[model samples]
Target: MFIFFGLFADPVSDVLLRISEAWPDLKVVRLEHPISAIAARFGENHYDLSRDKIPTDILLMTERLSSETPSARFLLLRTECFGGICDNRGRILLDGRTLFEAEGDGALRRLIKFWGADIGPEEIFEPLGRSFRWG
Candidate 1:
């Protein structure tokens, strides 16, 4: 029940499409708005923040994927790899340290791979190979 919001629609939709095609039983829900927005708009205290968290509590946000400036970071996740930075070439950094970098759609793929590790993509379908993953 990993809820996603911070990331853009490009990669998330791509993975969802593939997931739907392979595992029909796998449940993947895309909310029209973030939980915070929903709670604020509807005036309903549905989500209990103290007792329960938003699923896996993972949020990956990309500031500027393609840029030459040092200020252009690749990702900003909520947990695990939160605050991960990227160089002008999209190299990942954790806690001002280096983890790995991706070429072309590698950033998205690596995130997907991280997602798979948690959700067990291997148990459901064939490995999500890296190829034209970005659109």
Candidate 2:
């Protein structure tokens, strides 16, 4: 049970959706709020924490995905923009130092791939990929 916590970004949900699609047993949840539209599609778990702070035992959280990628972060934009995953407690699971570094490295590498920098995949993937983990 991973809790998607943050300012309620799209990428977060998008990635969780993908993970859920890949792993059905994985419980992806978010706070239920009026702002949430995915509640209809995914379930009624979508909510605004500020409005209703229902606490639950959370496992993990993913920080908000940035638009730093060349086009858009596949994990953040395409995936999160739809519906996000969250835990019953709402403790965000995506705020590890490694994950932050990985997002930065991945973003930079993605930009370099478009001729913005002269770095190698090893340099980029090492940090970015290092941040992500499977539970």
Candidate 3:
């Protein structure tokens, strides 16, 4: 299965890579925020992040997309929540809930299982605890 972990410029990629390694079969796509930002900075390219955007008051092309493919997985592995990354386009893809708030292991595993998929051991650590383990 394909799992997307949207991340901004941060140490999130480090953690996500570790998790993806544990699950060899799962396809994990790491989308960088700078790439999206570049797309935003240069609009003609049509760098649609996920073909999902929701209109909001602050921006024109602003849009929101949910996990329509319950089976197709995605996770927000960034430092900030949904509102922090809301851009002029307003097309942010992710729920407002924090990764910790998503209940870590249980919620994540369930989401995978529900889709008849398997999950790797990608532990979500807080910013302060980021250096505990770098394996």
Number of the predicted model whose lDDT against the real structure is largest: 2
Candidate 2 vs. true structure, TM-score: 0.20
Q: Is candidate 2 or candidate 3 better by TM-score?
A: 3
- Model 1 pairs whose backbones collide: none
* C-alpha lDDT (0 to 100) for residue 18 of candidate 2: 49
Segments in model 2 whose C-alpha atoms lie over 4 Å from true places: 1-13, 26-32, 37-88, 93-135
lDDT by residue (tens digit), candidate 1, 75-98: 322211223322111234333333
Error of 2 at 76 (Å): 18
Taking every candidate in turn, the Cα RMSD to the unseen true structure, in Å, is 17.8, 15.9, 14.6
Roughly what TM-score does model 1 have, to 2 decimal places?
0.21
Where model 1 places Cα greater than 4 Å from the true spot, the runs are 1-89, 105-107, 115-135
User: TM-score, each model?
Assistant: 0.21, 0.20, 0.21
lDDT of each: 0.27, 0.28, 0.27
Q: Ten consecutive residues with minimal summed lDDT in candidate 3?
A: 33-42
Indicate the TM-score of model 3.
0.21
Residue-by-residue lDDT tens digits, candidate 3, 29-110:
3333212110111121223445333212212211111122122123332122253221111112333212222433344443
Q: How far is candidate 2 from the true structure (C-alpha RMSD, Å)?
A: 15.9
Model 1 poorest 10 in a row by lDDT: 35-44
Candidate 2's residue-wise lDDT over 12-88, tens digit each? 34654644543354434442222221211212244333433422211122222222212222222111211322112
